[model samples]
Target: MNSIRFTKWLFSTLLFISVAVSSCQKDDNVKSMDSNKSIAAADSASTMGVINTPGNFLAGKGTLKITIEDSTYTFDAATDSVAFINVHSGDSKYFGITAINKAHTMSFGISSVGFAATNVNSKVAGSQFLFKLDEKNPVVQYTLTKYGGKDDSGKISIEKYNNDNLIAKGTFFTFLAKDDKVNSPFYRVEGSFELQLK
Candidate 1:
């Protein structure tokens, strides 16, 4: 009889412990669900200004043709060749540029040109231009033109970029007369062109 009574007490104790553990597990699940909801709500509230939507003009992919006036001076105190221009077109802009022939100019007495000094690894702060949308290393072509009895050539390139909060960025190339043919005492004639979107 004593043995049977002891068996019944053991069974009752195990049943009570199981019921308590199940109640605690249900409470933990409820707390986890509440935490997830709060995080989602905070994320939605953070991106409220300047373009929260993902499919705006700065979201989709498109091409724009921007034209900008050259704004630099040469040794003769005259407006130098248009190197890089920033044309702000809502969808497009015009870069007031001329084309140059690279093969012919290099064949002549002109010196070879190179890119400007800028950090390409990081994005420019608060910029509105996409310089290398299609490719960072742009392939450019030039065509020669006659200006003021001087045999001059123009260089040009086109670039593309994805949609972002800021405008696009790009770089252009120009090879000026580097020899005594320029008739200027200062033999330093080097410049570059740039395009930006705003």
Candidate 2:
């Protein structure tokens, strides 16, 4: 009778210890999994925060503003018409941004070739900038051509590009000539634009 009692007690004690250990291990594993999931969530949130900033044009309507010499021209989605063009032809790609004021008399345009979505935050060379103060009058047109000498050339830098949303934001600076003469007067033009691709 004494030997049987001792054997039963030993078996019960061993079973209790085994069960306790197994439960502890399971708890540890669950804690580790939870920690990893939290870390991944934090990383994802930070990445999105960096990509989507405040006042992002891709989130809504677009805007365009340019300064020509002493005059500043502004176009907004609320009152003006802003548009973007993306074209692929052969081995090259073309990107353009155009804006017209509500009055329909003033317009601004910039065009570049060989720039793609991968060119974000990088300067795109050989861009042409055009500003027309009077659409019906040819004399009021100003243009910056790629062949217009070093001082007359310009660059366009795209700050953000969203291929999924078909939106882009960029800035440009150029020296536009009123005429093709070497001694002709030129206006310093600088501006920024945000538009959805059409």
Candidate 3:
């Protein structure tokens, strides 16, 4: 009787071990397959001209293109609150505009900054405002010819918003004019940008 009991207990233990081992192997296989799929998707995006990057901005018109060195958002260190994106040059010239919108659906707060339209004839919606600045007198300003955002305020429209890739692309017909505050208004600006603000 004792011997029979020992055999039964050993058989049950072996069965449990086999089941656990098989499950582990299957899990590893699934993980490997998922990882491979991710790599393949990445390769396809680059090869197919899918532009997705944290540093992506392009807008121009005619022969002139706004010289954009970088784009960044600032936050107040003390309050941990949103500040602004600096599109300014070293000069104090007004090359950028700043405003706020708390209900920006772009996941970009302030659903596009409010454009007073005194500077632009059309409606405005962007994370940041673009313009030109006078390097010398530091009192000149320019509006946008081409702009980008995840809204419908601008003349341009959002062609695609890839949720899977977190990319927002659009077109715009920007018309940069100098505000009355400056010595004179700048030329009409126009262009398009396909920024991947992931």
Best by lDDT: 2
TM-score of each: 0.19, 0.56, 0.28
Clashing pairs in 2: none
Query: Model 3 scores what on Cα lDDT?
Result: 0.28
Q: Worst lDDT window (10 residues) for model 1?
A: 74-83
Residue range 8-108, candidate 3, lDDT tens digits: 34333322222222222222133344553344345543233222222221111111112223333322111111211212123311111122112221111
* Per-residue lDDT over 82-180 for candidate 1, one digit per residue giving the tens place of the 0 to 100 score: 112222224422222221111112111111122212332221111111122134565321211122133233333324322232222333333332222
What TM-score, to 2 decimals, does candidate 3 have? 0.28
Candidate 1 whole-model C-alpha lDDT, 0 to 1: 0.24
Two-way TM-score contest, 1 vs 2, winner: 2
> lDDT values of the candidates?
0.24, 0.51, 0.28
Top-down lDDT ranking: 2, 3, 1
Show the colliding residue pairs in model 3: 101-110, 104-111, 145-174, 145-189, 145-190, 176-189, 178-185, 178-186
Tens-digit lDDT track for model 2 on 1-198?
Answer: 653353234333323322221222222133344553344345543244321223222112567878877887777644454545443445645555655555555555565555546455433322323444455756366765333565445667787776655477778887777665777877768888776523
How far off is residue 46 in model 1, in Å?
A: 31
